[model samples]
Target: MMETGQVRDFAVGIEDSAIEDLRRRLAHARLPEKETVEDWDQGIPLAYVEELTAYWRDEYDMRRVGTVLSQWPNHLIAIDGLDIHFLHIRSPEADATPLVMTHGWPGSVLEFADVIGPLTDPVAHGGKAEDAFHLVLPSLPGYGFSGKPEAPGWSVLKIAMAWRALMAALGYERFCAQGGDWGSAVTIAIGALAGENIDGDPCRGIHSNMVWVTPPDEVMANPTEEEQAGLDRIAWYRTKDHGYSTQQSTRPQTLGYALADSPVGQMAWIVEKFHGWSDCGGHPENVYSRDRLLDNVMLYWLTNSAASSARLYWESFNSGEMPQIHMPMGGSIFPKDILTPSRRWAEKTFRNIVYWNRLEQGGHFAAMERAELFVEELRAWQRAATG
Candidate 1:
């Protein structure tokens, strides 16, 4: 059992210093000249950055964003000297199952703002009573509002324990867990750790959006026809995708300085992701309104958390013990998800592969890109798994 301190306050108003810092960085920003690269083929363009910066300075309202989120019941709790921020929405119905959904990199609890009410209190939100769920959305350690880990061992395994402690701290004994990206990895770790409370049985089951695995170098290198296909797929992702991880894992301090300084740079970096990995194909704005993009970027900027969040890559790469998840599991696999893990690979790891989905549309931001599809898929899996 874990002890909880007083509920922490929501981030409603930005201090003058934060705004001053943003302005100072933008003013001192040593911008590079535009390259021959015409499109986002070389990441966010210099011209686009200037345009967005103008909008941010002239029009965006931090107070308005804060007020909109204030409609919910949000709180932060300190456990083991780390401040963890999360939102709790209880089901009006007495017997609804509680499902805790966690997000991955470059995101915050803001990702779920649009979908929480619909999931938590479906009846009031004009959905069937059967679809209601109690949602507990938390910021990952060193991400967004959560305090950065002071020690090295706060890897996925430790973070899993922290989450279990968090859920238990809030008085939830048995709950379903869902996540995509690192979120999915943590959910798998939760089920593996189980009730040991780290006392009795590990926790209940977990539902996931992505799984990580590295094949034995021998077989993976000299692959069969089928394995060759997976290898080729992975290589494609590496060339176009792994650059960000490589930079973060190796030289985070250098990159952090720039990302932490300029809000315009931060927004461009984060927004480009919504464009690249979402169903909008190229136009990210189609899936995430400017309000949504700003909300996520604001979580990073106001809290000055861009660097700390990037440290997860550093921690994981160093640890090198990517555990195979062998517990009862549910999966929500999206098509354009960089490198979608194979079912053959997943089945080897997850003990009970109860629910497996290959979604038709939607991409990296499954919940945000296709909320209706994401929710319905989750509901379908939960119903089948628990029953």
Candidate 2:
């Protein structure tokens, strides 16, 4: 029996046996022969996967996820019949603004680990008390420690509404939203549905690292240098890197069997994204350590959430029409993201553009790869939105 809407304390507690089982699976992982190509064009090279698997099995600290996340107060609250897990960290500053940040696929709550302190306790992290935020970091349903959706229809919009319920249950009347990757899609949905009141609660604004918008034919006909670069990136992704998305969106269950059964399979599936999407300079290790990467992979491997998480793609990948958002919205466009929409293109959907900037460095995993910049962008957006 579960109590709906009750905010109960939750701690990550993976059994010792689960840890042993993961190592055993890694030990017996059956790998294929190395790729013929020297580069990642054929997919993540066999050698790199072998190297990562060895480190994961022999050297990586299995308890790192618990250790890193234990600093925050974790909680679980039932939202729309599913138990949602989140870290609700209040700032020491009395006037801190309430902000809900979401993480996307291939990313977990761990993505914000480095920036949590800076965002919640700005004074301690070389910022003013006014910049502090009461942060709510939720693990998307079916990912990490959150309960999986037993039925379909848990689309981005549904998740957005559930987040509203989650925040209202926490006593927040109004809050801002931020996200990247699929988190960006969720944040966009939140902004679209902001008018709906959860006991007078509303999402006041949104900031996203990944902005998705369709440019007008006129703009595409004669794109500026930066716009053209963004277009080229999109084209490249569609041609070279969209297979995983196609598989997940259309046939996640089939892909999930392998990912759920093999730890190395799960690791490689995600690590390739970290490599391709981040500003890693051709190697994922350029931006993230092996342990950090494993921390995210462990979330999926331990929970056996490969198929469940991928179902989100099937549910919302072609989310038909983009809703018009008139509320204050901000975007931080990173150079190396899969989709880099310029301000002109984004203005098509986001009517009230409060703040927009093109970052010099970073990629899809902004918070994880560039913590300082990600935090600063949020703070800057907060000032612009509320100022």
Candidate 3:
């Protein structure tokens, strides 16, 4: 393990040979026969995969994605025996608050690329300087350029500790945390670990788009119509949409062999989620452009993170314990997201609910689907946290 305090500049520098190899793999991909069902009920349509893979091979620009990442200020620092990769962009304001935003599985720091400039330079984006934040975007361990954890135990709690160590290494003694998906769980854990229970609380507050609020049986014993609806969604997910989760949690390594070898297979695995999870009407292209979607896929493919990233589920999915968080909390409920717990349910776990919103649009990948709204949501949550 490298020294904890060491931070060095980093960049996305995939060589031309790697890019060529990706194209070659896409060109020679052996796909399955068309699904008998015409709709996505079975899975991603064969036609769509064929078209997407064709575009990826012939027209999509890999270099552009690299350029976008290169333009951002990035670094790598060791924490808990992993060389965690992150983007650290400072606000021009002398007293700007430091804010760390985490990304989840099937997502990357790319989700927040558009919000970085706006968050770090609020004035340029038509916000007050006081709203500025020195943004920190860390690629989760084993995802993107971050080194894979060599051993087990890099659960949400451990990642939260790593985030704190990261912030301290970067000279931030106090900061706020924001996230959605796995990022949300990590952010909540930070708040839970704060104060007298753990290390001194470096986290001032937390905001999440996908918060965990596992209400007790009594709360669910007589569910409201809305609560029942939320419960129904969860049930539906476990019944229909949870195959991937079950596989990832129990046998990620087995699935990884195929994902790591077949570019088309990897693309199909991830692209299906964006279609199912996003509010992209009927097609993923309704929200994400071809390049934008492919860029995220490239992060996972290039890093060969299929098994390592899925191992996160193996570590935490069945832990059956929710950390208690008493810090100021904010949540945005996107109607189309995979899970949107009722505020009543959320409040049971997030004790101090300072801000909550049921946004009219957006979905699971809200940052990418609704960048402007995501920014406003963060700013609103920040105000509630700071004030």
Candidate 4:
């Protein structure tokens, strides 16, 4: 297994030909007509997509991004024959907690780049001294720089185990974990399996900022007049918001085929989520700079990972990974997300629920959309749970 520090470079780096290909694909994009949906219920608008494509083709600079990221200390390790990429930013402070943060689908370690400088070196960033950390942001297997797992069994649970090994390799005996979306699920698995009361246990505490808490059993079990009214609202949401999940889980490749082929197709798919999920309401450019948003798209574009990323959606469903979320946990539920699982319902899966946050804003891509808020939320939970 190669050490992360050795293979820290993007293994499948894009060549000039790839850029030409993307431009060609975008130029000849055979866009289909859509009824003006008014809201983002259907998908991204053609106008917005064309603008994003223009920026991508004429302006986005992936090399500049790589150089900026090069300032950080990066590492990778061959885990079970797959090279797992990560950024291990060691705090200047000698006694910081080893905190491992994982990214979710359609996102990369790049998502946390903004907050890492502040989190690890807080005194320098106008934050308190107590905010120090040995941050370990890992690309989940089959995402971004992490090698794709050719085999099955590399589910969320397996990824958590890999992270435990990653922390151990870094010489951290005791550490904490944080995540959102798929990240939340992985961290939950780690916390639940921590200190198994048997030999060879490696996991520690977990803090997550993306839990879609459902309705309480009391309400779900026996609905009151108001609870029944609440159910009606949620039932309507399920009809509208659940389509993406259903498509992602059941037939990711069908969607991926379209996205993987065209840069414009991929941008629309990703940018639509950024728009709908972000606190910007429906305007993606409001929260993120065109450069920043395009950089994220550029990562996928450069690496050519749209299809592989979608396959994760298909695998999660095929492997029956959702029901395995039973674990000790803390969660931050955001109002902007598709569904909010009630604390009562969350406790069914997360038995040792210590901290539950019902945030006013943020959504599915919580870390990327509202990174500063996500960072603070994770830091708050990490302190509360550990101290």
Best by lDDT: 2
Superposition-based RMSD of candidate 2 using all C-alpha atoms, in angstroms = 2.2
> Tens-digit lDDT track for model 4 on 1-387?
223333344433457787677778767778777647776667787677777777776777746556555678766787667788888888888877788988786667778878887788878877666778889988888777677777766777677777877787778888888887787767766775654431244444677766634565576888666445547647865775557667777776687777777778777767777776667856887778887777777777666677667666666654543342433456777666545666665665665666777777777667767777776776676666656
**TM-score head-to-head 1 vs 2, winner:** 2
**Candidates' C-alpha lDDT:** 0.74, 0.91, 0.87, 0.70
Stretches > 4 Å off in candidate 4: 1-14, 62-64, 195-201, 212-216, 222-237, 318-328
The candidate, 1 or 3, that scores higher on lDDT is 3
Task: Encode model 1's per-residue lDDT on 91-150: one tens digit a residue.
Answer: 887677778888998777777777887787778766777777888888898887688887
TM-score of 3: 0.96
Poorly placed runs, candidate 2 (over 4 Å): 1-4, 195-201
Question: How do the candidates rank by lDDT, highest first?
Answer: 2, 3, 1, 4
Compared with the true structure, model 4 gives a TM-score of: 0.86
- The global Cα lDDT (0 to 1) of model 1 is 0.74
Model 3 superposed RMSD (Cα): 1.9
Worst lDDT run of 10 residues, candidate 4, spans 1-10
Over 57-115, each residue of candidate 2 has an lDDT whose tens digit, in order, gives 99999888888888899999988789899999999997899999999999999999999
Question: What local lDDT does model 1 show for residue 68?
Answer: 62
How many backbone overlaps does candidate 3 show? 0
Highest-scoring model, TM-score? 2
Query: Between which residue pairs do clashes occur in model 2?
Result: none
